[model samples]
Target chain A: MKVDIVVDARYKSCPGPLLALAEAVMKASPGQIIMLLATDPGAPRDIREWALNVGHKVLNIEKADETYQIYLEVSS
Target chain B: MSKISIIVASEKLDKLLPAATLATTAAVMGWESEMFFTFWGLLALKRDYEPKEVSSDYKVYEDYLRRAVSSGAMPSWLEILEQGKKTGRLKVYACSATMSFLGVKTEDLVEYVDGVVGAASFLSKAKDSDINLFIS
Candidate 1:
């Protein structure tokens, strides 16, 4: 099953929420898809680097107005 | 898959903020994160003693509290936990042994705590975690 979470990170700049989302997705066993919704302008670049470092797949990223949607697939 | 478990052991307000910040960061990275507060750290979960304007760096305890309140940060320990909870990725657990030693009940803890758990329980849950952090 796919786990989808929407994070409203507009008020905070720290990478905490994005890190948490990635961890949650990884714990969902292998081959699970995690969809993260974030409004933070820095999320895309930060999350991209984080995913690469952790060996997760950054499937796609889509921008919708002021928010961004990131889809990540757990590869390990 | 990444999972992290954090153990908080200090009651000092300043120390707790850094730990909470790290926990929030772990959660944001898509990790299943759990924080176990024990010993002095339990004091930080109390409902009273909100720090309003705390200085990020303090040479003394009083200065820390004064700056915390002046900065309009957290004036009470409970408020700090509330701010962490609002991030929505953290699970806060109070140590059961500490509560018993202090003769405190679970209801006496701040509302943000998930439950009162023991060290064994916490360790078991953390066995599979990719990262384990201890904040003292």
Candidate 2:
């Protein structure tokens, strides 16, 4: 789907994308999808884990080469 | 919610790295994370907290660690902590007594430090935490 907000965390450090995601996700309302494009190999797992821990839901994640494309929905 | 409190009492880069790693992870996991820098650790919170490989009990690993860090194999402990603070619920605290003894002021500390606290306050927070770690 077309997400209005895209956070490009490509080449960012570990946990950096998580923080970016946290910050970006807050800008959108519940039900809005936020896309995170990250190059950090560990960011997918970090995002998944953090999403679960915070009660947010990750709709899907796609891996293209070494980069991670994650789609997350903000939970109210 | 669970909480994790780390007492950083050393100046070693290795110790501080793991402490920051764990603190950030805890916070990202929806757990409150607190870091108390005391004694030797407080030295690292200074405004000029440069990353260096300091020799600890692990003397044999010093050269290897230093080389690896210089070669980009590792980020400085301060770098790790900065990343943690950017995205996590991590709070960094400097020890009041240590600051007094060292004549360090809040302005002398890194800008990220959440606050300066004493042992009693640190203890109170630690007591309520789910995990407490003493890294020295």
Question: Which candidate achieves the best lDDT against the true structure?
Answer: 2
lDDT of 1 by residue, B1-136 (tens): 5778889988766666667766765555555778998997787677664433333355456674555445543333343344446657679999999988877787777787888889899999889988899987
Q: How far is candidate 2 from the true structure (C-alpha RMSD, Å)?
A: 3.7
lDDT, residue B39, model 1: 91
Give me the TM-scores of chain B across the candidates.
0.77, 0.90
Q: List the candidate 1 regions with Cα displacement exceeding 4 Å.
A: A1-76, B51-69, B72-84
Model 2 / residue B41 / CA error / Å: 1.3
Determine which window of 10 residues in candidate 2 chain A has minimal summed lDDT.
Answer: A11-20
Predicted structure 1: clash tally: 41
Best by TM-score, which number? 2
Model 2 C-alpha lDDT per residue in residues B1-136, reported as the tens digit of each score: 9899999988787777678878877776778899999999999898877756654577778787677556644555665676568665789999999999999989999989999999999898789898899998
| lDDT for each residue of candidate 2 in A13-37, tens digit (9 for 90 to 100) | 6656776787787678988889999
